[model samples]
Target chain A: MALDKRFIGREYGPFVYTIGAEKLREFTLAIGGAVPGAGTPGEPLPHVSPLLHDAQAAKAGPYGDVIAFPSFAVVFAIRPFSAALSDPEMGIDIQRVVHGEQELEFLDVMRPGDVMTSTGRIADIYEKARMGFVVVTTESRNQHGKVVVTGTWTGVVRG
Target chain B: MPRTFQTGDTFTHVRECDRYRPIYYAGASGDFNPIHIDPEAAKAVGLGGNILQGLCTLGWAVEAVGVFVGDPGRVRRVRVRFSKPVRPEDTITFQGKVTAIQDGRLTAEISATNQRGEDVLKGAVVEASLE
Candidate 1:
């Protein structure tokens, strides 16, 4: 079934997320190929930057604090897209949905303790090649009201 | 010394999706969708088995550019199309080429391919600030 185009422009969130130092380290290591064990996010890999996991180095380096890996914004920025997928009104079959594409723009380095508020809306709903596509565009701003990140999330529903 | 970037400069990064990667990533990223954590649930959904989240692959693409620019915080943008699922034990190689440098920003095109020579991401591009 095709998604109803009427849902276009429907909005989701004001979702708020607070960046934490440990969580930022965990995400950086996990994506950097560190294997986790009980109660540990594993050792940081060589390619993983110290600015992302080491407090002292980061404090001495450029950002003056640990910085979230740019893509780490997805942790909270995904709220709106997730909401739209699970929205009963959209009737999207979760089991048949796959992330089709993603685009993210980081305007500034995200640091621990930064409070980010994100809001997104359904940008488009359409079908092609028998697959239904849902497009969601999001913008996240810091507590200072500065735009920190913008995202375009696309999900494809398999027929 | 600041690094200089030019069009056609290429870099590479490789990562293996270990058996427990999806679970670890789910814990880290808060994406616990069954298709990423439970093999049985993924099979039920006709996915054959659990798959790594597409965002993880995106992260790798960003990492490649971050490494090239010598600072993760300098990365400004990334875009990718998820063309195929990356399963456990799959090793992915990301190759990035500097495609443009203008003002203070550098743009690169990246390709993500699995051990089987299958493309997992298409039309991937990443941009980073040089200053």
Candidate 2:
């Protein structure tokens, strides 16, 4: 079944997320191939940058603090896209959905204590080769009112 | 001394999707969708078994460029199309080549492939600031 075009312009949020130092380390390490346990986010892999996991080292680096890995923005920036997929009106079958594509632009580095507010809307709805595609565009602004990140998230609903 | 990058410079990064990596990524990213954490659930949906979140693969693509540029914070943009699912134990290799550089920004095209040489991500591109 095709998604209702009526939901094309539906908006999802002004979702608020506060960046924490530990969460930043966790996310960076997880994607950097660290295995986490109850008390640790695992040891940082060789390729993992110290600026991302070591607070002291980061404090001495250019950013002056540990920074979230660029893609860590997705941890919070995905709020609106998640909302759209589970929105009852959209009636998207979660089981049949696959992330088709993704694009993210980081305007500035995200650091701990930054408060980010993100809002997004369904940018388009169309069928391609018998599969339905839902495109959502999101903008996240930091507490300083500066745009920190923008994303284009696409989800494919398999027929 | 500042490192110089040219239009044809290339770099590579390799990562393995260990059996529990998807579950660990799910915990950190807050994407607990059963397809990523539950093998049976994924199989029920016709996926061979549990699959890693596409965003994780995207992250690796970004990591490749981040490593190339010598700083993760310098990575400014990344775009990717998920061509196939990455299953547990699959090792992915990312090869990136600088495609352009102008106005203090550098752009690179990246390719992500699995151990079997199957492409898992298509048209992957990343941009970073030189300054």
Candidate 3:
């Protein structure tokens, strides 16, 4: 894998995309898990919330009209991870991989109607017992580059 | 503390939502956690029966709010915390409630509970409006 201690401190693209609800539903359904009639169009909203302790802080985190989710930060770095692993020089056998862990750190609050831009970098790498830890930390921002959410996705490579 | 939801309020029917077929999902999502697939491995883990991963359960929460948000596009964000575990034979119900409305944003609280009345997961979701 071209991913290791060397890639640390390397920043990746600011790929952006909108989070869709039905896709979320389909994901659950495809996995043989369904929340009854949840995540459907015009269906009653499912119970999910964020406690915005302050209105102004939440407002500042918004990006135009699209409010972003806490996990929404990962979408931004998906492309970067692909590019790095897919690099001709880096032969990452993705088939034998497992999603080790994922963590999100928010610098500011996120609200609905906020369109965000996610930019990220390979933050840290460590060799654990029988596992290689690859960490990518991402920063989500508004059009103005204001920080919204910071996310980290870890892939535990077992070769 | 006691929290209550009224009629028309959406919540995870972890009790009613049952018949989880995770093996098919394991093939689709590329998540083949043996604890989810191999019943024997599950027993090794003290599950006695096949158990589902927390992420698979999170998918339920994401979809439950997706309908109320009016299109996946409206669903702005979802964050979940894994509180407990879900087993294969255990039926899960997603329960939700709209806690706030900020202009075009709808915020709801949701959780996944097993038939035994234990929360397998807990989290909040927020949605944006096309309008």
Candidate 4:
């Protein structure tokens, strides 16, 4: 079955989530940020590598506190797509879906304790070679109504 | 302290995706797609085995860019197209170069490859402000 083109521009929830410091810490560690010398040897250094074991440095760092990692925006921004894709009318085959690409732009730094409201939109939906491609663009705004991050996710669903 | 970046400057960053990384990322990012956390489920779908979340790999890329810029928030834009599945135990190396410096912004082209030199993410671009 082909994805309905009418679903393009479909909008989903303005879900709200408050960032937490502990969550930020956990994400850093889960990716092995908690240990030193874990990355590929030499050259480019991991950003969070410095703060993995030292909490004090992270406090005085650029963002001035425990800030979410740049890609951490996915935590809050990805929820609405669940509701959007699963909508009965959309009829997206979830089982065969695969993430094809991702784009993230950070407009303002996101700090822990900042409540964020995110809205999801179906930016595009098309069919190619019996495959369905859907793009979801999610915009997250801080409590002050300032746009903090925008994430564009492209999913390829096999036909 | 911000350092000036010149065109042609290069840097490389490497990260390892442990066997349990997908589960951890799924927990943190709320993406429980079985392909990431279920090896058998992934094989059932012809994936051979579980794969790492594409966004997680992107996270590592952005982290590399942030490390180069010296400020995490300075990363204004990051984009990547996933070209291959990153499997557990794979080490991804991100090699980037400053392609242009203009109007106080530095632009770089980055490419990530796994242990076998397979391009996992390609056509990656990052733009950040001069620190």
Error of 3 at B21 (Å): 1.6
lDDT tens digits by residue: candidate 2, A1-159: 588887888999999999998899889999999988889999978998898988899999999999999999999999999999999888888888999999999999999999999999999999989889999999999999999999999999989
* Every model's TM-score: 0.99, 0.99, 0.50, 0.91
Cα RMSD (Å) per model? 0.8, 0.7, 10.0, 4.0
**Each predicted complex: what DockQ?**
0.89, 0.90, 0.11, 0.56
TM-score of chain B of each: 0.98, 0.99, 0.76, 0.96
The candidate with the higher DockQ, 1 or 2, is 2
lDDT for A30 in candidate 4 is 58
Q: Weakest 10 consecutive residues, lDDT, candidate 1 chain A?
A: A36-45
Find the 10 residues in a row with the least total lDDT in model 3 chain A: A44-53
Candidate 2 backbone overlaps, count: 0
Q: What number of clashing residue pairs does each candidate have, in the order they appear?
A: 0, 0, 44, 1
Model 1 clash tally?
0
Q: Write the per-residue lDDT of candidate 2 for residues B8-115, one digit (tens) a residue.
A: 999999999999999999988999999999999999989989999999999999999988888999999999999999999999999999999999999999999999
lDDT of 1 by residue, B30-130 (tens): 99999999999999989999999999999999998888888999999999999999999999999999989999999999999999999999999999998
Candidate 4's residue-wise lDDT over A1-159, tens digit each? 588888888898799999887676566655544432334212222456544324587677655565666777888888767777778898776757888888888887777789999998999988888888889998999999999888888888876
CAPRI tier of model 1: high
Candidate 4 residue B11 C-alpha distance from true site, Å: 0.7
**lDDT of the structure predicted as candidate 1:** 0.95
Chain A TM-scores, one per candidate? Answer: 0.98, 0.97, 0.61, 0.84
